[model samples]
Target: MQKAHTSFALALSLFLAVSCTNNKDAEQIAPSLSAEASQSSKDGILTSELSKPIGMSIDQKNQIWVSQSGTGKNDGSVVVVTPNGRVQTAFTGFGSQVLPNNELGGLGHVLYQDGMLYVLDGLNGRLYIIDVSSYKAKDAPVPASSLNFIAIKPFVLSQNLSNPLDSNLYDLTFGPDGRLYIADAGANAIISVNLATKALSVFARIPNATPTIQAVPTGIIYDGSKFLVSTLTGFPFVTGLAKVLQISTSGVVSDYRSGFTALTNLAPAKGDDLLVTEYARFVFSPPVVGWQPSTGRVANAAGTTVLGGLNEITDIERINPNFYYVLSTAEGTIQKLKY
Candidate 1:
């Protein structure tokens, strides 16, 4: 186990981008861990082989968090791992235990706010508030079948808005002001929910004129002030536009960046830097999945940063001031980067 863990990390380290330097030489090549993998598992490293590492979030304690949805017959789950890759806890919800691999059960997206963890139920379209200290669902499931008639029933958040979300409620996060934000990729809208009163409102919606199959907003991140979002374009071949839409505390939305494809996730680096993963090749005949490292001053937003090529980037997080952690779903490896 130790050797396997080290090999995985070494493979993933090869792709981390060091700086915003457009020059190829400035890109940082991660040191191979194959030589040290013998010490990995013994050191408490955790690893996985799954379809996609769909979403992640960090708690006040700074523990790294992640969720994976299996393709079919795979039994999806949510995992909490230490900075060193040790498994903290893995959740396979009570009712979801019988869900098929690709049925979208288990955990889809996790959000940590105050001292609670909010998880979106992919199969049932329900939102569960989990006690961070306990890691258990606050209430039972709220089925879409009875959502309309119910009155803010069972953590539904709101009956005034759409209930039983259309499809996979992919990503979720809280804004700087404390209101809860969720990305409904299936419904094509970014929504904000009142945590205190269970009221729901659409924060941002993908325009129908986008000229893609359908827009699926997968990830949400707060850069201390605004909410940054990632949208997977609906059409194949056309690079899925991964854009950042800035939303103020007042619910104002503005275009931040586009032209990049498959912006699946985002994390803040030290200074004004961000680590963006580009799965540009996912829409092809055979999915060309890779991760890219890019850095730039915050003012530029997008389109001007120096972007490196893909390197199996599934999820990203700023583990510390200078180190960023990335997940490679296919490689089943986690990487640490210093930028």
Candidate 2:
């Protein structure tokens, strides 16, 4: 029954990806993507080219690994691009096959650790761990393409919860405490799973807010003592209520910042500061458009800031002591922000 539902959801997403462009007008329907930095803060840098970048993580080599959930079929793939904007290698989705009129390779999120690249399959509730050292998908008993892959291996994590409904884990990162914190967007909760033991626990469940569907959770990070989670109000109007919540190790969640909408991914930098990627532009959805300047922290904020001009910020990472690099999925370009 769950597999059937997942198939339907994937089909719908693929449909949206195809007609995403203005079919009647035959024009790509991206955000207005204004190249103007006029309305942006001095901190906002403008650029395009990040290619629908959704998930990101820094490898041991410090290069940025990006996953492109393209706008349509033939657009999805995994890219290993250097900090200097050079494409190293590209891996196409499972096979070259694209479902008839369906989008392919919607590779959503990625994690690079312990010489392995773990990709969370958004189309299905499955995890694909690639051996970074081998550059090949790991040798799972189910051949790496089967939807029934989970039962084939003992690498599965165990959670105490009796109910196992699909939550569609999105952005994930290791907390300061070394536990894996996953944005269980389907359930709007930040899930903490012990990496060493795979014991799972619900760290926090997002409280209901305006435009109920926008309650979808996205990015997450930990800064020594607290965990920060990003929210994208998945509604049809301008609620402008997306926020980042600060959760303690004990699992107490609080609204650390509010008023902004559709912030997707996040990363931590120096001096108690964090970087966020915004994904507010949608045509079949919202009307807001254009390249707003790459907005992020110039200096560590005492609290989160509710501002604008950030394109679909999908990922971030601290390159050096006070310098951070941000990836804009909408623009396909990276910004180097100096704090």
Candidate 3:
């Protein structure tokens, strides 16, 4: 890739020609979850007490990789949890380019495929590619270092600490078309990353009036066909305006659900319809909307309730054809949910 800096076509072709290796590790680690893990109200905490953790994805062995925010520049890190629930720090960043509070920037989300890991460094407007395989010539992954860290120009927004779009990057999911789909919340747009060339582009942008307050996207996924994006609105994040948008491969955007208040993530349920998580309900205060500790919940495709009383969930993963797991960023936990 370093050499390809002189040859764009060579880089893109080499990247596009390679199919993502389906390294079995992307699925469940166990043939079957244990009895204790299968309980109806299962609350098996995979990892807990994290420092402002946000995004996560599973690897070949069902080890959960999480993006954790640090207190200052260069403190953000990526951590992993084994199938048996042991946690390990995989790597960290040198720090973000801008920040006012600790939570706004850092390594925000992670996407794992085969032995490769893609991390979004929101503060610096860059993407870090890490080699997760045992034979990586540089040895195992380490903090503040990477196999590659490519700069994304679009994410280099106003470093003004007051900019509401500061959470420049949010969630990420791999598209069947061999690209990475990213939720650029601050810019009110969905971005696509060319894996081969490490190029960035605005795939789809919400046509709303205020990107600074209205159209922050958080969660995104590819359902083997089209894409679904979740958006957050207003600061302290109000309840009414947040929603999920249906995005086409050609960059068309439309509302999939408009009634959701403080929506965080989306995933297909074990049965029919889609499953969504709400960040919080509306209440009175200067921060008109805020997270209610242990109050997040999930709903079905038709906007009907399914599960309730969760703790500030940011992402969800369906591990099988029958069950799913949700991430609580606040609680730093992952709990299995049976739909």
lDDT of each: 0.48, 0.51, 0.61
Cα lDDT of model 2 by residue, 214-326, tens digit: 35667776666777777665543234566778888888888887665456666665445555655543334334232223443221234344334554455665545544556
Instruction: Identify the runs in model 3 with alpha carbons over 4 angstroms from their true place.
Output: 1-42, 94-98, 101-103, 135-141, 154-167, 209-213, 286-289
Cα deviation of 156 in candidate 1 (Å)? 10
How well is each residue in 81-178 modelled by candidate 3, as lDDT tens digits?
66556567778664542233213345567877768878877666677777786632234558576447777634434332223333356678777677
Tell me the lDDT of model 1 at 303.
Answer: 47
Q: How many residue pairs clash in each candidate?
A: 15, 20, 6
Question: Residue by residue across 248-298, what tens digits does model 1's lDDT show?
Answer: 666666766766665556666555655566543432233323332331111
Runs in model 1 deviating more than 4 A are: 1-52, 60-62, 71-74, 94-106, 134-165, 283-312
TM-score of 3: 0.79
lDDT of 1: 0.48
Against the hidden true structure, what lDDT does model 2 obtain? 0.51
In order of appearance, the predictions have TM-scores of 0.65, 0.66, 0.79
Error of 3 at 242 (Å): 2.3
Candidate 1: give its CA RMSD in angstroms: 11.4
